[model samples]
Target: MSSANLDPLSRNLLIGVLALAGTLASFAATTAPIQAAQRGAYEVTLPRTLDASGRGIVSGTMWCSEGARCAAPANGERAVSLCGEVASQFGEVSRFAGPQGELGSDDLARCNAAVVRR
Candidate 1:
């Protein structure tokens, strides 16, 4: 129903409720994006495409798809450590970039060392 048909008291109440809802919606909108911005992301380029088997993914936080691409939420971890996990799951990382920036050559070497010896 339209607010114009309401009694004055009910109209004011409805306006107050809508204003409060708008305030809450705006507050929620601000905070959610801020939290997401604070949590940086990780992207990886693998040396090869992961097999279509379940082994392709690293963890719940990391998602692998579309051939050699993988991504995860950085979640305050170092590039080196996160890269190691990705390398361990999939294989050597062709490129690893995260909140702390891309892994250096030495770091990449160390990260790849965690690869399973299979």
Candidate 2:
């Protein structure tokens, strides 16, 4: 039945449903473009070498590139989320660790790669 011919209660319910849907559509439209425009990327390096027993050792540093193409949330918490996403691109976070032995002493080669912004 047409909304105009429906009871007051039914008419109000229909209107509310339509309004809620419209609000959701607007929200999606507004955010989709913003997310697409915000571009950012990061690179994580891992060093691998065989140990005395022939097991491989993995460790390295993470680097992020900055510029107009690289965009991340200005907010601290949200920015951290972006950083987490960047890190995930490489692999799990556990793969990254500090120098295994003595403090501030690592014998591995340094990572000098740059991140390309998305």
The candidate scoring highest on TM-score is: 1
**31-110 in candidate 2: lDDT tens per residue?**
98777445322222233321222211112323332221122222222322333443344322212222121111121111
Candidate 2 clash pair list: 39-71
Give the residue spans of candidate 1 off by over 4 A. Answer: 1-14, 53-60, 116-118
Candidate 1: tens digits of C-alpha lDDT, residues 40-106: 7888888787777423445457465557887766677667877787787777887898876788899
Return the lDDT, model 1, position 104: 84
The superposed Cα distance between candidate 1 and the true structure at residue 115, in angstroms, equals 0.7
